[model samples]
Target: MTEHDALIFLVALATLLGMARLLGEVARAFGMPLVVGELIAGVLLGPTVLGRALPDVFQWLFRQSTPQKMLGAYTTVGVVLLLVVAGLEVDLGIVRRRGRSAAFTSLLGMILPLAGGILLGFMLPDSDMKNPNQRLLFALFIGVALSISALPVIAKTLLDLGLFKTDLGLLVMSAAMIDDSVGWVAFSMLVGPMQGNSVEFHKLLTMGGLSLVFVAGTLTAGRRGIDRLLTRFADELHGGRVLSLVILLALIGAAITQALGIHAVLGGFVVGVAIGDSPSLREQTRATIHEFVTNVFAPVFFASLGLKVDFIHAFDFRLCALVFAVASVAKVLGCSVGARAGGLGWRESIAVGFGLNARGAMEIILALLALEAGLLKEQLFVALVVMALCTSLLGGPAMKRLLYRAQEEDVVALLRRGGFVARLNATTSRGAIEELVQILEPRLGHLAAHARNQVLEREQMAPTGLGDEVAVPHAAIEGLEEPMLALGLSSDGIDFDAPDGKPATIVFLLLLAPRRLDEEVRVLASIARSVIDPRAREQLMEARETEQVLKVLAESAQRIAEERRARGPALADI
Candidate 1:
C-alpha cells in the first residue's frame, strides 16, 4: 500500500500488541492459558465489539483496504516464525527415550480422531461445506485439525503440575509431538491440491513427493550443512550473526515449502526439527530465537486469529457444542485407549487423554488455513475456534482432578529404603556421583558398575541440576527390578554445571529399569514437590547425622503429601 495505509497498519499492530499482552496477563492471573486473553483482545478489537459500538473508529483503524493485506503479510510472517519455534521445541531424542508407550499413544491418538473427523465431515449438510465439490479434501482437513495436539499447551500444563521433567510428562509430550508432525504432514498433503477446486490427483502426488524429498533430504544432508554453518558462524562471527542465519534459514525453508505447493509452515517446522535434533545446537542460539519469536511474533499471530472472525454474528451455539463434543470425546477416547493398550492404569490413561486433548495455537493455525482455502465457512470457523478454546481450557483442570487422589500416597517410602548420606565427600558432580555409587555397590552387586556408567552418561547428555541448589541425576538401568533412589547432601555445594549456575547442595540419585519408569516418575514427583519448601531443603542441609537427615526428608515428604490431599497437587502454586 500507500503511505496512509502504512501508518494505519503500524497503528493497528501497536494496538493489537498492547491489547494482546494486557489480556494475556489477565488470563494468566486467573490461572487460564495466556492465549485465551489474547483471543479476547482480538474480539474486542474486531467486528464484534469495536465495529458495532464505534463503526467510524473501527473502520479507520482496520480499514478493509491495502492495510488489511499488509497486516495479513505480517501475520503470515508471524505464523512462519511460530511454527519454526514449535519445530525447534520438538526433541526427537525425547520421543525415543519415552519408548513404546509414546508410539502407541501417538498412533491411536491420530487414527481415532482422524476417523471421527472424517465421519463428521460425511454427516455435515451441504450448506456447511465451503467447497461442495471438494468434499474429500474438506474431510481430510477436518481429520487433521481434530487429530493434532498443541505441544505448547500440554507443556505449560505439565509445568504447572510440576511434571514437565517427569517420565509421565516426557511421555505425553513425546506422543503429542508425534501427533503434531503427523497431522501437519497430513494437512500438507490434503491442502496441497486446493488451488483450482477440482482436486488433481497428479498435482497432489507431485506436491506430496516434493514434500517427502524436501523433508528427507534436509534432515540428512541439509541438516549437516546447517549444523556446520551454525558451528562456524558461532565460533568466528558474533552471536547475533548466528541468530540472523537461523532466521534466514527459516525463511528459506518456508519459501521452499510454499513453492512446493504445501503450506510454508511445514518447511519451517522441518528445518526447526533438524536444527533441534543437531548435537551442535547451542542453548544460547535457541534462546535467541525463542525470545524474539515467543515475545513478539507469537502474541501477534494468535491475536490476529481473533480479528478475522465476527464472534457475535458468526457464533452458532449448536455447531460450537457439536464441534467441541466431537473433538474432545474423540481425542480423550483415542489417547486413553492408546495409553491403556500401552500398559498404563485407568487413572494414568485418563490423565494422558486429558493432557493430549488441549488444542491451542495449532488448531487456530489450521482453522485459519482452512478458512483461507475455502474448506471452512465463517460460522464453522467460529465453531472450530470455540472448540479449540474450550478444549484448551478444560485439559489442565481435568488432569489435576484425575491426579489428585494419586498425590496422597506415600512419596518417600521407596527412597527411605534405598539410603541417605548426610555428608557427601565430593565437591563436583562426577565425584559426588562416584561416592554415592560406591556407597550403593554392596546393595547393587554386579549392576553397580553399569549403573554408575549409565548415570554419568545421562549427565553428559544433559545436566541433571534443577537449580535451587538441588540436582536429580537419574538413569534407566538394565538390571534394576524396581526404582531406587539415594540422597546425598553437600554442605558446601558442588559444581554440576546447572542451568541456574548455582552449585548443587542436594542430590537425588535415581536408577530404574524400563518397566519401572512409571514408578520412577512417582518418586521424582515426590522429591520435586517436597523440595519446593526452602526450609525443608535447609533442614536436610543443616542435619548433622543420617538420622536427622532422614527425619527432615520424611517430614517434608509427609507435609507435601498431606497438602496435596487436602487441597490439590499444585506444586508450582506452593
Candidate 2:
C-alpha cells in the first residue's frame, strides 16, 4: 500500500476505536448494552451519516480494497476469538446439572423458531421456486437466525442487570447455551444439502461415527496429553505460551472441521466446550482467551459488522416493518412457549423469550456469512441486521419490565411453598437488622427504639465492614412483630473498619430474630454478596431518594428469594 493509503488506514482504525470506546461508555452510563455503542459507532462511520456528511474524508479513509480486506480479516479473527472466549466462559457443569430443563427449553425454542422462519419464508412473495433446494436453504437460514439466542450477550446482560446469580438468569443462560449448540447442529445439517451433499443413511452414520470418535479422542487421549504437557510447562512457561497453545489448538480444530466440510465455528465451539468442561483447564484458558479477545480484538469484529450494515437499505420502511414483525414474533413465541412448557411462570416465561430474542454479534456474523456465500441477497441481509438490532434493543426493557412486575408477596409465597420461608414476612429485608428496625420503629414505642439502638451500638463496637466499600450491620432483637430491614445509601461513602481500609458507602442492616441466628446469618451473607456487584453497588450509591433506595433493595431481595425458591425445596424448606 502507498504511504498515503497506509496513513488513511491507520487514521480510520484510530477513529473507529475511539468512537467505539466513547459510544460504549455512553451506553453503559445509560444502562444500555456496550454493543449498542459499537453498533452506533459503525453507523456513524459508515455510508449513512459521517460518510454522507464528508464524502471526501470517507473515501480517503475507507476507500481502498486492500484496507477493506485488511479490516475484514481483522474482524474475522475477532469473531473467532470471541467465540472461543465465549466457549471458555460458559459453565458446562451447570448445563449438565440442568440437563433436562436446558434440553427441553433449547429444543422447543429452536424448533418453533425454525418452523416460524420457514413458514415466513414461504409467505414472502419474492421467494423463488426455480431452485427448490434454494428455498429450503433460505428457510433453514431464517430458522437459524430466528432460533439463535445470543448466549454471550444474554450472560453479559444478566450479569450487568444483577441477574446473573439469580435463578432466572442461570436458567436463561443455560438454555441459551444449549439453544446455540442445538442451532449449530441444525445449521450443519441444513448446510449439507447446500454443499451438494446428500443426507443419506451412510452420511448420517459416518457423521455419527466421526462425532463419537472426536468426542472420545478429545476427552480421553487429547485431554490427558494436554494436561500432562501443561503440567510440565507450568513451571517452565511464563508469559504467552499458554495462550499461544490455545490459539494453536483453536486454529487446528477449526481447520479440521473445515476439511470435514462443516463450518469451522462448530469445531471451535466444540473445542471450547470440551476445554471449558475441564475444571483444571477452564480458568486458565478463559483468562488467556479473554485477555486477548476482549481487550485486543473485539472492537475490530464489531466495527466490521457495522461496516457491512447499510443503514440506507435498512431505512426502507416497508422492509424494516416486515423484518421487525417476523423477528419479534419468532423470538417471543419460540422462547415463551418453550419456557412455559418447561414450567416457568408467565412472567418468567416471557422473560426467557425476550432474553433469548437478543441477537447482536452472532446474527450479524451469520448474515454476513450467508451474504458472502451468495445464499442471501444484500437487501435480505439488511433486513436481518435490522431485525437483530431491534430485538437487542428491545430485550433490556422487556426483561426489566417483566422483573419489575413480579409481585413481591407472590415471590414470598413461592418461597414458603418451596419450604424456604418458615413464617417469613414480606417486610424482612433478607434478615437485614438495621433495615428491619428502621421499618418497625415508626409503629413501635420509644422503649423499642431504645432497645434496638442499644443492640446496634454494641454490634458496631466491632465494625461489620468487610472492606470493598461494603458494610453489613446487624442486631438481634426479641419480640418483633415481623422481621424487617432498613437499607441506606450514601454516595459520599462512610468510614468503616474494613480490611481494605476503603470507606463503606453502602450499608445493609440485618435485623434477625434472636433465636434465628443461623438462618439470619445465611440471609445476611446472601445480601452482602449481592451488594458487592459493581452495578448493584453503583445503583445503590446513585439512589438519590428513599424510594429509589427501597426499590433497589426490594429488587435485590426478590432476586435472592426467587433464587432460593428455584433451588428445589432444599433452601426453601429451610
Candidate number of the best TM-score: 1
Question: What are the per-residue Cα lDDT tens digits for candidate 2 across 1-574?
Answer: 7776667677878878788878877876665666677778888888777677897877777767877666666676666667676666556566765566566667777787778888876666554322345765677677777788777778666644545544466568788887776665555545445554223546645655565566457656776676676666766644477688777777776677667766666666666666665534523345556666765677656665566656775456665677678777777877788777776667778877888888776787677776666666666777777777778777767776676543232212212221111111322222333444545465445635754674456343334665567665555566644344545554555554453556566655445455432234345435654564566677767766555555665577666667766765331121
Supply the TM-score for candidate 1: 0.89
lDDT of 1: 0.81
Write candidate 1's Cα lDDT for 322-365 as tens digits.
Answer: 88898999999999989888888878888899999988888988
- CA lDDT, every model vs. true structure: 0.81, 0.62
| Position 218, candidate 1: lDDT | 83
Residue 522 of candidate 2: its Cα lDDT?
A: 42
User: In angstroms, how far off is 260's CA in candidate 2?
Assistant: 2.7
Clashes per candidate, residues 3 or more apart or on different chains: 0, 16
How does residue 344 of candidate 2 score in lDDT? 68
In model 2, what is the error at residue 257, expressed in angstroms?
2.1
